[model samples]
Target: MPELIAPTVRLHAAWLEAHAEWGPGFHEDGFGLIPADEVESAAGFAAWVARLGDESDPAKAAKAGGAACTYRWIVEGERVLGGIALRHGSGEFVQWAGHIGYGIRPSARRRGVATWALGRMLDEARVLGMDQVLLVCAADNLASVKTIERHGGVLEGIRNTKLGPARRYWIKIDLPIT
Candidate 1:
């Protein structure tokens, strides 16, 4: 269990960057975690996202206080199945989104990666003065809702975002530490 590092992708790019078995899957079931876990795409998208979350990206880093604040979810040693991005500002985060967003690769789905990843991010948030956190997901995303609940998330309300029906789950950081 490694600490979820902010923009934690590049740290483990040795596999994600060079490997062919695990790359971005457009219509194919590359990793089997996204579609297997019921996510959109589960290939190297996680890795690409990690790169976008990089503090060195310059463009993305400028708006989000550098990628050093993003979090990466790594499991099974060298594999980075998913990650969460944390932004500290009055931007797209505070309104519809929250402090973090996450995804797990297709190959690593249904194995409690979502639960552990969210848990890892929560720990990071608490350490960063975030007494409470907000997590938004589509109303139809039952799997995501369940994962959020596993970490003690309480439902705030449902919002009809432009994308679709969304649910806002709140997690209190003040609760007794587990």
Candidate 2:
């Protein structure tokens, strides 16, 4: 079984193993990783992890003038499977990037990891009082399209983004019946 947990430096080596599996680039969508983030060294990885936590802090987000985001890694025991992020703000960035982003390691694909992690994040979104969430993926990515649709995502259309054509979807969060 997979579990969703906050980013931690204790999984440094495990994360690198997952990172390497994706090859070179800042394409680990759910990790909030930027090209400038130095995650190769222990100190750097720790700092990056700290920054991820800070991004989740409303106070820090207010100070930074950016969206508050929650990041979680999908893991089974000590092995990192993938990552998922739920953005808690609506703006141009969120509109273009969507409220959620995720990526599974190449080796871990087709095992329902993305589906499971996305469901977990939607639960988190519900807890945060989000009525609905947006998710955008490459139009060519049938796997992601299916995953979004499986979670009750409604098509919002495809648009040409800076990253290219993307299929945008919105999933409504069903509040619990009292």
Candidate 3:
């Protein structure tokens, strides 16, 4: 079974492979948006991991221009299925960026990886004391819309973004954490 794990250099090989498979434009939303070039080498990946660690602290995260968040990779043993991030608080960009963002590799799509990962991430958010969570996705991303809906996400509305139209949904997570 896939489980959430802290980012570690031990998964660098799998991380690189997944990123390569996704090609350009692969969104690493939960990962502090680290550029592809920054993680091209082992040392670079290690540095990126350390940076993510720093960003998890509230003070450091604010200094870096965001709220405190925990980043975790969805993996089963050595294979990385995907990644998810849970932001501790909603900031000015919450309407567009939402509290959580995730991405599953192309090879892992349509296999319920994203759905399962998201469910787990929501649970993580609950543990962090969030009563609910906001999720935004591209208006055209039907799969993501369905995934969010499956988790009881209620459509809040759609708004224009630099990237285009985005749909916003709010998922009440006050119930028992799954």
Candidate 4:
């Protein structure tokens, strides 16, 4: 596998925490697992169980979608090293979470895993009819700042959210559907 686009998966806690590197971020808000399938154990299933829901509202549905998200980030073969989930714009999510969220294991941090994974998610957003998308990260998160920047994200300014302070960005996804 050349150092380019990898695969993503949706996972459970057992699979997430199984690797010592994932730690706390896997279960937080705007949180997700990379190599997404790392969460396949019975414990993982239990953690994910609380998030599954069928909602009528798009916003509500989007929240459920984020919890139920099963996409993975794959590097090389048979590796579900990371994943991303889409949070629909609604209430606080609109002002904060953006249309996508992602994570890669600590072991894989500077390998461009986030940049690669987010690019794929952006492509998916384009497929979903989103022309431009908003992404936010903590003002102190230099890693995410670089990842988003490498993916053509434009800085929009900073804002304080219920979650914390964040630097917001926008990406004009120009993918045309074939």
Candidate 5:
């Protein structure tokens, strides 16, 4: 079964291969939110991995200009299927980006990978003390909208973002964490 695991160099080869398959400016939806330039080189990838560790500390995260976050790779064994990020605070960026972001490799799409990964991430959010989590997706991204809705996401509204119009949904997580 696929599970969320802490980001590690052991997955670097898989990560790089996945990115190469996706081409440039790949968005992991809620996970690999870093600038594309920051992940282009080995050194850049190393820096990004290091930054991920720092993002768990509020002070360190503040210095970097955002909320503390926990990032994980969704993998079944050694293959990296995707990634997810759970933010631990609120702010303009968080409000715009939502509390979580995630993406699945093209080869892994249409197999309920995103749905499963997202459910796991929501559980992670609950463990972090979140009562509800905001998840935003592009208005045209039917698959994502369906995934969010399948997980009990309620439509909050739409907001204009640089990327275009985004549908915002509030997912209540007061029940038992799955």
Candidate 6:
């Protein structure tokens, strides 16, 4: 069974295997990877993992004046499957990209990994006091649409973005009765 875990340096080799499988690009989405991130070296990967951990710290994020984000890697034993991030804030990125973003490795597609990971992130959002969360995906990504819809996401229509036309949806988080 797959489980969510914080990014760790111990899994650098496993992560590199997964990253290579995604091909050459910064499209890994939920891994919090950026164009300038040098994850090829052990030191660079460790720094990147540290950066992700800092980003998840509310105090650090506040000090940095950025969104506090929770990044989780979907893994099974030593194998890395994918990742999901729950971002908190109404910043421009959150507005354009959405509160949550995720990607499952090509080999793990159609196996409910994204769905399960998304569901888990939604729980994280709820714990952070979010009443609803936004999610955007390529307009043509029917798989993502279904995954979002399965979690009760309501379409707010498609819009053209710097990345091209994308479908936006809002998933209302049902707060657990206190």
TM-scores of all candidate predictions against the true structure: 0.65, 0.98, 0.91, 0.68, 0.89, 0.98
Residue lDDT tens for model 1, 58-88: 4676766643344454545665555555545
Question: How well is each residue in 13-106 modelled by candidate 2, as lDDT tens digits?
Answer: 9999999999998898899999889999999999999999999897898799887999999999999999999999898889999999999999
Model 2 deviation from native, Cα RMSD in Å: 0.8
For model 5, the superposed segments whose C-alpha errors exceed 4 Å read 36-41, 62-65, 175-178
User: In candidate 3, what are the lDDT values of residues 1-178, reduced to their tens digit?
Assistant: 8889888989999988887887775475555654453787888889988887877788998898877888898888899888888878877766568998888887888999889989988888887778999999999999999999999999999989999999999999876645
lDDT per residue as tens, model 5, 68-133: 988888898888888888888888877998998888888989999889988988888887788999
lDDT of 6 at 132: 98
Clashes in predicted model 1: 11
Model 4 Cα lDDT, one tens digit per residue, 1-178: 5122322224333334534465543443234432442345665554443332222135555655532232333444444355565554434645667766666656656887677778777776776677888888888999999988998899999989876789999989896957
Please rank every candidate by TM-score, starting with the best. Answer: 6, 2, 3, 5, 4, 1
Q: Give the TM-score of candidate 6.
A: 0.98
Off by over 4 Å in 6: none
Q: Model 2, poorest ten-residue lDDT window?
A: 58-67
| Candidate 6 lDDT | 0.95
Worst 10 residues of 1 by lDDT: 26-35
lDDT, residue 176, candidate 2: 79
The positional error of residue 158 in candidate 4, measured at the CA in angstroms, is: 0.9
